[model samples]
Structures are given as C-alpha cells and as structure tokens.
Target: MAEKIKLACIIDDDPIFVFGTKKMMQYTGFCDTFLIFKNGKEALDHLSVILIEKKPIPDIIFLDINMPVMDGWQFLEEITKIDISETLKIFLVTSSETQEDRDKAKKFSAIKNYVVKPITLESLQELLPTI
Candidate 1:
C-alpha cells in the first residue's frame, strides 16, 4: 500500500466536487484525515488559527481558483504571509484549462502543480506519488 498522507485539505465551494474527491481519497487511502472548507476565507481563517497554535497543518491542499469570499489567488497571497511549515504542498485544482491560469500559477513558488478539475482517479493516483 502507498504511504498514507497524515492530513489533506480541500478548499472548494462545489459540494459535488468535494464529495467525489473525498470519496476517491478515501478509496485510494490518500490521507488519514481531511480538512474541508467551502471557500478560501474559511480555509485561511482556520489555517491561520492552526498556524498560531503551531498545530500540524495539512500535508497537501487541493485549492480551487474561483470561489466566493477570497479566491485561490488571494488565499495563496495570504498563506504566504503566515509562517507556515515548509512541508505544506498546495496544488491548484481548478476547471480552468487556459494557459494564462497555468502561467499565473507558476508565479507562486508555494504551488507544487496545477490540476484541471474534475479530478480523476488516475490523476489522483499520479498525484499521490508526487506528494
């Protein structure tokens, strides 16, 4: 079996995507636990508190680009301000297929990679090894 991730997070507003991704992560044994947030603001708020408490943050975060109340770009900006652990890996999970978005994602050194959504099992399988 693949080594399990200690914790993973999903920051997306779409319930369907979140449900499917969570189910797939469970099936694949991707992570032992999950932290889910509907938007970047909620995620940032919780993560900020976690940071302050010096708790273990998510090992990986699957972030969406377009969300209400602070989008992914804003979250990335805010997260950089926080003194987060270096081990945190964030993957941009969005429906955008445009090259512009991909280029923009590259600007952030914190971002590990960008995966176009509806995340597939094969994609997750591939992603697990990298993380």
Candidate 2:
C-alpha cells in the first residue's frame, strides 16, 4: 500500500467539491488529516499562522483556480515568497483545461501537477505513489 499523507489541504469556495473530495480521500485512505478553506485568503491567513507557529504544515494542497478572494494564482505568488517545507506538494485542481493555464502553472515550481475537476478514485490512487 502507498504511504498515507500526514496532512492535506483543500482551498476552494465550492462546498460540494470540497465534500466530494474529502469523501474520496477518506475512501482511498489518502491522508490522516485535512484542512479545508473556502477561499485563498482564508487559507493564506491560517497557513501563515501555522507556519509561523511551526505547526504541522500540509504535505499536499489541492488548490482551486477561481475563487472570490485571493485566487489560486495570487495565493501561489504570495505563498512562494514565504519559507515553506520542501516536501510540500501543490496540485492545481480546477475545471479549466486551457493551455494558457497549464502554461502558467509551469512557472511555479511548487506546483506538482494540474488536476481537472471531479477528480476520480483512480486519479487519487495514482497520486499516492507521487506523494
């Protein structure tokens, strides 16, 4: 079996997607803990405090591209400025499949991959080895 992730985060405004992704992760035994945020600003604020306090940072983050406050791109720009652990993996989980977005993601070294919306069990399973 693949090793379980110690912590995982999901930053998105959609409650349905968050709930579904959480269920999928639970079903796959993907992670031991989850930190959910409704928007990028919320995530940034909480994560900044966590980082400052030397708390357990998330091993992986599933970030959404579009949101009300502080979109994924902005979050990425800001988060990269702070000192973060090397093991941290970020996956851009969005419904957009545009080449422009894909190209833009390449600029951020922190981004491990781009995953389309409605992520399936198989896809989650595939991610286990990488983590």
Candidate 3:
C-alpha cells in the first residue's frame, strides 16, 4: 500500500473527465483526500484562501488547459504569485493534442509534467509513483 498523501486536486472544465478522474482516484487508492473544481478559476480562488489561512495545500493538482473564465495557464500564473511552497506538484492535464500546449506547459517551471487526456489507467499508473 502507498503512503497516505494529504490531498490531490483536479481542476478541469469537463464534467466527464472530472468524474472519471475522481472515480479512478478512489478505485486506485492513489489519494486520501481529493478535491474537484469545475474550472481553474474556482480552484485558484479556493486554493488561494487555503494558502492564506496556512492550510495544507494540495499534494498534487491536475490542471486542464481550456476553461471558460480562467484557463490552466492563467491559473498557474496566479499560483506563482501566491506564497505557497515550491514543492507542490502540479501537472498540466488536458485533452489538447497540440504540441504547442505541451511546450507552453513545460515553460512553466512550477508544472511537473504535461499529461494528455482522457487520462487512462496507464497514465495514472505511471503518474502515481511521481507524486
């Protein structure tokens, strides 16, 4: 069995993807605490509050590229502006197939990796070790 990590967070615009990821996390024992946000903006807003209150930030964040108000890219920028520790692992998780998106995500040093979606068993299996 894996160690009980504090929390894992999912910030995606698609409902189906969020549902799938949540079920997978529960099924896999990958995380003990899980948070789901509809878009990057909502996640950022809530996370920012947590940051200020000195609450335990998420252990990992699966961020999506496209969204209505604030996309993953914008959220990443906002996250940096906050004073959270540098050790948190953030992955750019999205369905965008473009190489440009991957390159852009890589440019942000805060992001640990870029993962394509609809994220599968193999992807999560591979990702589990890293977090």
Candidate 4:
C-alpha cells in the first residue's frame, strides 16, 4: 500500500498564494488534508487547541513571514514551545528572498525549509520523498 500522504496546512496572508499552493499540491500528489489560515496567529492558536485535544499534528505546514497579526516569527516561537514538536514539520513560505529572512528562519531549527513564493512542481519535488 502507498504511504499516507497528507497535505497538512498552509498559513499565509495571501489568498492567491494559498490557491496556487493548493493547486501545486494537487498536481504533485504531495498532500491530502490541507488546513489554511490567514495568519500565523490563527494557525498557532487553532493548532494549540488541537494539540491539547490530542489531535494528530500536521505533517507539514507552509507559513508566511509577513502578516498583520502574530507574524511567522512570533508563531514559530510559540509552536516550538508546544509539546507536539516531533509530529510537525514547519516550512517558511515567504516572498522575501533576503538573506536576513533566511537567516531568521534558521534561528528556528524546527522549520523544515525556507520556500520562496509561488510554489512550483520542482520545489514540491524536493519535499515529497521526505513526506
């Protein structure tokens, strides 16, 4: 049997980006159950409740850096303190290509990778084997 592959989540402020990522996930067969939130605060809050309820954490999450409330960096700080570390893979999905952003993402080792905007099939390919 094929291994279960779930497209766990995407936390971004841009709807277009979310739509594109969803389409890419569909094309690549890289994800199944996708949970999307408009900002990192909402994502982290919801996930925290799930964690408390003993819910299965998402296998992978695509998080955006810039937002109105609780930016990705703040969210990362909170999520890392949660008890569900082993069950989650967090990826920073940002439009910024700045080395500062990359370096900031590196500060949190929990982040699986830093993905540039407009996710592509080629980019998705790098993540499939791991999932």
Candidate 5:
C-alpha cells in the first residue's frame, strides 16, 4: 500500500462533491484526516486558526473554483498573506474545464494539479506517488 497522507482538506460549496470525495478518499486510503469546508471563506478562517494554533496544516487541499463567499482565487490570494509551509499541496478540484480557468491556475505555483469534478478513487490513487 502507498503511504497515507496525514491530512486532506476539501473546500467546496457542493455537499455532494464533498461527500463523494470523502468516500473515495476513505476507500482509497488517501489520508488519515479530513477537513471539510463549505466555502473558501470558511476554509480560510479555519486554516488561519490552524496556523495560529500551530496545528498540522493540511497535506493537500482540493479547492473548487466557484463558491458563494470568497471564491478559490480569492482564497488563494488571501492565503498568501499567511505563512504556510511549502510542503502543502493544493489541487483545483473544480467543474470548470475552460482554458481560461486552466490558464489562471497556472499562475499559482502552489497549485499542483487541476482535477475535474466528481473526484474518483483512480485519481486519488494516482496522486499517492506525487504526494
């Protein structure tokens, strides 16, 4: 078996996507712990607290593009203000497949990959080695 990730975070408004992704992660033994947030703002707030408390930050983050409060891009921008470890890996798990979105994602070096919606066990498995 591949080594498990210490922690994984999911920031998306879609409950269905969150539930499905969690299930797949569990099935694939993706990570030992999970942090689920409804939107980018919520995630940012919680992560900011985690940072302040000197807690173990997420090993990987699955961020969505569109959300009600503070979109993924906004979160990315704000998160830069905080001192996060470089080891943290972020993946854009969005439904958008537009070239513009892809191009925008490339601007962030922190983002490791762009995954389409409905995250799968196969995709999680594929990420193991890279993580």
Candidate 6:
C-alpha cells in the first residue's frame, strides 16, 4: 500500500464537488483524513485559529478559483502571510482553463499544481508520489 496522507483539505463552495472529491479520495485511499470549507473566508478563519493554536495543518489543500466572499486566489494570498509548514502543498482546483489563471497560480510557490474540475482518480494517483 502507498503511504497515506496525514490530512487533506478542500476549500470550495460547491457542495457537489466537495462531496464527490471526498468520496473519491476515500475510495482511492488518498488521504487519512479530510477538512472542508465552504469558501475562502471560512477556511481562512479556521486556518488562523489553527495556526495560532499551533495545531497541525492540512498537508494538502485543493482550492477553487470561483466563490463568494474571497476566492481561491485570495486564500493563497492570505496564506502567504500566515506561518504554514513548508511541506504543505496547495493545488488550484478550478474549472477555469485560461492561461492567465495558470500563470497567476505560478506566482505562489505553495501551489504545486493546477487541476481542472471533475478531478480524476488517475490524477490523484500521480499526485500522491510527489506529495
């Protein structure tokens, strides 16, 4: 068996996507545990508390670009200010296929990759080795 991920988070407003991703991750044994947030603000609030308390943060974060009350880009910006672990990996999971978005994601060193929506099992398999 492959090594399990300690924790993984999905920060997106779409309940459907979250549900599906959670289920898929479970099926693939991609992670040992999971965290979820409706939007960037909600995620940031929890993240701030966790950081202040010196709690263990998620090992990976799958962020969506489109949402209300701060998008994925905003979350990325805010996280840069917080003291997060260097091993933490963030992947921009978005529906947008624009070159601009990919270029923008590159600016954030924490962002390991950009994945298009309807994430596949194969993609997760490939990602596990790197993380």
Worst lDDT 10-window in candidate 2: 79-88
Q: TM-score for every candidate vs. truth?
A: 0.94, 0.94, 0.91, 0.89, 0.92, 0.93
Residue 51 in model 6: lDDT: 74
Looking at model 2, how many pairs of residues clash? 0
lDDT of 5 by residue, 1-131 (tens): 67787888999999999888888878777665899998899999999888767788898899999999899999998887787555558999999999999999999888999998767777877776787
CA lDDT scores, all candidates in order: 0.90, 0.88, 0.83, 0.81, 0.86, 0.86
| Candidate 6 residue pairs in clash (backbone atoms < 3 Å) | none
Error of 3 at 20 (Å): 0.7
Give the per-residue lDDT of model 2 (tens digit) for 31-79: 7589999989999999888876778889899999999989999999888
- Model 4 C-alpha RMSD vs. true structure (Å) is 2.0
lDDT for 121 in candidate 4 is 77
lDDT, candidate 6, at 99: 98
- Name model 3 segments beyond 4 Å from true: none
**Lowest-lDDT window of 10 residues in candidate 5?**
79-88
Pairwise lDDT winner, candidates 2 and 6: 2
Shift in Å, residue 62, candidate 3: 0.6
**Alpha carbon lDDT of residue 109, candidate 5?**
81
Which regions in candidate 6 have their CA more than 4 angstroms from the true location? none
Clashing pairs in 2: none
As a TM-score, model 1 comes out at 0.94
| Better structure of 2 and 4 per lDDT | 2
Error of 2 at 91 (Å): 0.7
lDDT of 1 by residue, 13-129 (tens): 999999999999899887758999999999999998988788888888999999999999999999888875565689999999999999999998879989999899999998888
What's the residue-level lDDT of 81 in candidate 2? 79
When superposed on Cα atoms, how far off is each prediction in RMSD?
1.2, 1.2, 1.5, 2.0, 1.4, 1.4
